[model samples]
Target: MTRSVYVTSIERGDGRQIVELGVMELLTRRVDRVGVFRPLVHDGPDRLFDLLRSRYRLTQDPATGYGMSYDEASTVQAEEGTDELVSRLVDRFHALARDYEAVLVLGTDYAGSQLPEELALNARLANEFGAAVLPVVGGRGQSAESVHTEARNAHRAYAQLGCEIPALFVNRVTPADREEVRDQLAAHLPVPCYVLPDEPALAAPTVAQIAQALQGTVLLGDDAGLARDALDFVFGGAMLPNLLKALTPGCVVITPGDRADLVVGALAAHSAGNPPIAGVLLTLGERPGKEILALADRLAPGTPVISVAGTSFPTATQLFTLEGRLSAATPRKVETALGLFEQCTATGELLDQISAPRSTRITPMMFQHQLLERARADRRHVVLPEGTEERVLHAAEVLLRRGVCDLSLLGPVDSIRKKAADLGIDLGRARLVDPTTSELRDDFAARYAELRAHKGVTLDLAHDVVADANYFGTLMVEQGLADGMVSGSVHSTAATIRPAFEIIKTATPKAGPGTAAGGEPAAAPIVSSVFFMCLADRVLVYGDCAVNPDPGARQLADIALQSAATAERFGVEPRIALLSYSTGTSGAGADVDKVREATELARARRPDLPIEGPIQYDAAVDPVVAATKLPGSAVAGRATVLIFPDLNTGNNTYKAVQRSAGAFAVGPVLQGLRKPVNDLSRGALVGDIVHTVAITAIQAQEPG
Candidate 1:
């Protein structure tokens, strides 16, 4: 039987989308094939469902997500009966549930719903689908006592209907009334209750939404600016100076387009980020002339300037009623909603109550989720040297918003801030440092000079080198100011990791009997790298792909050990396979001999670990091939960590798998370093940067 959770609300304005998104996040974290079903939806596009689909990379057909439209449901229930309506819905749900391990059943929204007994209808559908009911109650304008009674009644109502109630959520409660509501509900309800305080940002409308609602023309704004939440609306009826004083950080200034002075003044204030108004709304269908419009564009490059035909009074009333939605276009709001949900809800307890079974296969999405969860578990500070880069900044916003880790972005602080502001991103609590002018520059330069004195490096020369962002960022890791560093989005691998080698150096093994000929312990091999090849069914670790051009037998063994450790650390069970052109002594050559020797050496080092080598790629991965070529080998056909004989083979193989097989390769994650320092592809996307940063944070949590 497939496990499912039915997310419903008692009334309109319950803000149940937050609960829905949060539950979806939880489901995707545990299962690979998670389905989404909406029992009854409006005729138009479903914004919340679209958000879930895009964010989670869901593959469920959009047509299958809905049982029927609200209009259709109303007609069915009215003409035939409630039983006929539910029977059709249950059949539609089971059709979707059959293909998924778990399904998230989205219940009917009570807003404008014409079906009689909406609450009872949702309860009946949840019971029929065998899904645990998670009810949300609105508390935005209710008293604490009223909210308590409502939440209690919600739980009782579902329980009385024979629906298994997992928990109750009281959303959009005032901050002052959250604790009071929780206390009162805790004494009454059997299930756990979570209270989410009201977030004005979630309720605020974006300038684009307002423009669309009013059918206005967008005179000036980019997509990012249009997505800015209009947290407040200020009517611009006064002079420019007084209008500037009324501006708020995310408010939209409404005035007649003929008021050129107010338009330019408000935009100028926004450009200076004095309050950073969300946009300027021009009414009465009167746009400014070319000169004034040009001046406004120069003042605020991406600030929205919308022109509507309505007067200020009617437009203000319309704006007040327009609320922001959680949609694919509003990524910032999605992050905010998830952040708010994670803060208020005990995710672990709720998930336990829901008890969705974990998927046996580790999908790419699940691996990425595990990376974030592990990184967030023990927060570490990871530095990004390319702070001014747009992808890095975007990834920084996501990391900070998700509470993944503390970050220190190395660049000119003002440039980063201006760029972020232009892109409509908020780098909350992220530490920004300029390598050239930071107070620690002198200290870093002196230290670099001392460390490289034997190389004839002078203080001035060292000063210039230390002023580079990668060097400064690496030095911060060396000096314990940061836990790790992730660079190379724009820089070459050498430019990024060269600083790490020069300053942080490699780790040395503990003094033991197997010492070097000079009676000193040997340092570990120069840092190796691994690319987590996330195939459709599982994540495989490919080592030495981005480093180590060629290695002797001993270095090959070292890479194998390091790769296996990296795999196990990230939750992949390590079954080592030393790849060669041959399988298990079937062929002999310098290359195959090296792999065979390395396999023996690695097995000698750790006898308990599953190890196979001198194996053909086909034999190593395909069970049928393994049975024919090398039967009954533990690592054959099920290898999770693959060590190539040299970089030439490893790099080409990972690329082939990534491109030919359409795999999502996550690394080139540098291993064997004293601390974590990962590299990124020059063509990396925003999501790729986020995954790399999270991986770096997790690596930093490990002991040297």
Candidate 2:
């Protein structure tokens, strides 16, 4: 039987879409094939469903997502009674459920449903569909006591109707009242209650949404500007100077199209970023002349300028009632909604309650999801040295919006701010540090000099070197100002990791139980790197790919051990394979001899580990070749961690697999460091940086 979750709310305006989106995220994280079904939808496009399809990359047909429209459902209920209506919905739901491992059943919206007793109708549908009910209660403007009563009533109502409610959610409460609401409901309710505070960003309409709602023409601006949220409305009826004073950040300016002076002033102010407005909404269908439009375009390159057929008064009325919807077009809002849901809810416990079976295979999406969940669980402060880079800035926006971890962006503060503004990115609460002008520079310089004193480094030279962003960021990690550091978007791998090698250093091996009290210490660990080859079915670990050029038997064994630990940390079981040009004793060469020796040494050090060596790539991964060449070996044909004898072979093999097999290669992730510091390829995309940052944060969670 397919597991399913029925998300329903007591009334409208509960902002249940956030809960829906969050639950969808949780489901997709665990299972590969998840479907969405709405029992009764409005006539137009379903915004939330569209978002789910786009975000999760669903292949289910849109026609199968809905049972029927509100009109058809109302008429059916009115003519054939509730039983027929529910039966038809149940049949439609099962049609989708049969093809999916789990289905998310979106209950009816009470806004325009003519069918009476929507709460009971939803409960009946949920019971019929055999889904665990997750009810939502709106607390947007309600008092604590009122919200408490409503939450209790909702749970009781569902329970009485024989619906299995796993949890109750109270969304859109004030931040001050969030805890109070949760505590109050905990005392009265039998199930866990999660409370989400109201986020203005989620409620604020974007410029594109407003334009679509008003059916206006977008005269200027690109997609980035259109995505800005309209947090406030400013009616531009006064003079230019007066209008300038009234403009606020993220506010939309509503004025007549003929008012060129006000338009020019607003655009100029926006260009200066005095108070960056969302966009200008020109009313009365009147637009500026070609000359003025051209000038306005120059004033604010990407800022939106819209022309609507309605006058200012009517536009204001429409704007007041319009709210943001979670759709494919609004990605930032999706991040905000997910962040809010994850913060307020006991996600793991709730997911357990939903009880969807985990997939046997680890897809690329599942790997990425696990990375984020682990990183967000124990939030760390990570520093990015390339703050002015466009890709870094965009990734920072995603990191902050998703609440993955605390961030400190290193660069000139003014330059960073200007770049972010031009890109229309809101870096909320990200610490911006300019190494040259920062007070910490002197202290960092002193520490660097002290660490490098053996190299005869003076204070002046150390000061200048520490002024470099990479060095400054590494110092932040070394001095405990930051937990981890991720760089190398534009720098070389050596530039990114050199400071760590100089300051943080590698972990010193500890004394074992059998060692004498005053005996010499064990060999210190070497810093090696691994690439997580995310294949279609499973993830593999390829180590020493980007760090070491050549290694002896002992160092190769050490790399195998480090790679195994890194694999286990990332949830991949380690079946070690020491790759060589030959399989077993089939051929004789120095490289094969090294791999065989390394395997023996690794096994001697960790006797319980599954280690096999002198194995060809085909013998290591292909079962047919393994059976013919190295039969009855535990690690052969099932190796999750592959250690190469040299960097040349390792790097080339990983690149070949990545390009030929269409695998996602995440890393060059450095291992065996005291603290986490990872490098990125110079051509890294925004998503690659985001994943690296998450990986760094997760590595920081490990104890020294």
Candidate 3:
């Protein structure tokens, strides 16, 4: 009878940090149970709020094994004639509300003419304690008329206790008034509206932290690596080319260049050899432009650069008035201050279920991602490109009109029915191609003479590049007709890796001179190609950006078994690290003996790999420098899958850690192809080509 949900938060200083970050982020989006009960003592004492609630243990409710009953009365001293302190807080929280199933009662700073008289004494204690009255408003200049008087006092005291559901928390807001308080309480709140997100994570900003937070000067404009720990909030005052046309790159924040032509045109369009600019904050003294320090020394040579000198709105108002003593942030600025540590360091289950907002999930609609919900539940297909076949035919007619996917499109059936009747699109029973017919020009001249049969094709040059309607778009993905294929707009990732290495290669084959994260692997069998890199729940896979340039250490043990079989085909357990410049048995070149021979030949070809390496990228991602230097190396300190050793150190260390590693580099995500094929970077970013066509439509049924 207790699936668990006992939450009792109504705040002032500690409504247990936004009820332990919205009941462990709504029990990681709907129930596996969640806990956290008492910790309220504000009129300045309950032994100093039970000594800061026993410094963070919060009495108890660690899901099911319940906790919290710190009484010490005066919740704003009887807010509206307190029925004996609201019947002793519903008799000590209804004796732990008859051992839980759902108890979310929140409302601490409860008053201001007693919020409809303390929501009618928290609705006779959620109806004499069965429990479910959510209201937690906790202030800081709230107003939408104090969130429409706490949603008309939790809808007239839960419709005089008949019951309704809608918990509201605006909590100290001001990231430009959170979508106007979610556009005036999203059609006036019924329940579920948590808004936390302005954390800056401090520590590395001195002059006694920029004279106690204001007026800048930490100059060292990193190509974009600028002291690599990424999350860019660069808001240089109005029309600095409207803050470089409000930048759109992973975790970008670069506006305070004091408008030296929009800070040297957003440091020559984002730095690091030119593409890196995650940190180069020159507000009023706007420095760094000897071509952004020679493109940050040809991108990331001595990266970490900071320089602040005020005037970018009093240095973003002394960084939101020292955003609560700056929680030491720097791992590319953890989402630049995850809204003040989502009420102080994400708690319990992982709180996220306010039903899809701004849409970005990648996984968890109850543990999904088996190649994206099994190529969207077995109905696969999705292609689109004839001028983005009307934006993948309106995302494949809304994923086959909501049954969710089985549509394709290449071109010329009368320019895709006059561009889907001039974009009023309807391809209802979809599936079309015409690459100027004749059985699609003999399947685009046998996939362009099987990718230029070693560069000498001529049946009139494979009928002039398979009749150039863009080589029937890589011959609708080498004639499977299309389970997956989302080409780089006008083509060139060497025209999408020469027809997937002459029509789909790698079923698992590679040897001698293969693994090229930088280069020198493969005495044989280390075939390379990677990109998995999800982002939402944090995935990571990376290897030879999209195919080798210099691979060795037994072709980096077949590019760490194709990046740990595409991070266990996306459920992710692959820890592999390999990146070098030394960690274990410290430095000694031949490029740290080719990342300690590709970490003992990828732990002797995947001997249950959680592989490590010559290491150091801060000891493979800093878990306190992998517990002070490789303590029991389970892949150094929790590496998700880094593996570079060549391809100019994996395409300039993933475009200089995708403009200085703050976070959000979804991919060059190609992986060892047989089915999914991707490559778009000439002007990539129609949201990285709609997440590279949703990672080539979740590799339409992967078996190839």
Candidate 2 vs. true structure, TM-score:
0.93
> Tens-digit lDDT track for model 1 on 1-704?
79999999888889899999999998998999899999988877899889889999887899999899899998999999999999999999999999999999888888787888999999999989999999999999989988888888888888999999879999999999999998888888888999999999889888889999999999999988898888888999899889988998788899998999999998887776676788889999999998998998887888889999999999988887888789999888888888788878888789899998988878888999888878888999999999999899989998888888999998988788777766667776899999999999999999999999999999999999999999999999999999999998899999998998899887665333333445443224558999999888888999989889999888888888878878988899999999999999789888889999988877766666789998988888899999999999999999989998898999899988988999998878998778888899887888889899999999889877
Give the winner by lDDT. Answer: 2
So what's the TM-score on candidate 3? 0.30
By summed lDDT, which 10 consecutive residues of candidate 3 come out lowest? 349-358
Backbone clashes for every candidate come to 0, 0, 72
Position 154, candidate 1: lDDT: 85
Task: Supply the global lDDT for candidate 2.
Answer: 0.90
- The digit string of per-residue lDDT tens for model 3 on 290-383 reads 7765654443343334456656576666554442222222222222232243433222212322221222333322222233234444565656
Regions of model 2 farther than 4 Å from truth: 61-63, 258-261, 271-273, 284-299, 510-524
**Best prediction by TM-score:** 1
The TM-scores, one per candidate, come to 0.94, 0.93, 0.30
Rank by lDDT, highest first: 2, 1, 3
Model 3, residue 514: what's the lDDT? 28
lDDT of 2 by residue, 389-415 (tens): 999998999899889999999998877
TM-score of 1: 0.94
The number of clashing residue pairs in model 3 is 72
RMSD in angstroms, candidate 1? 2.8
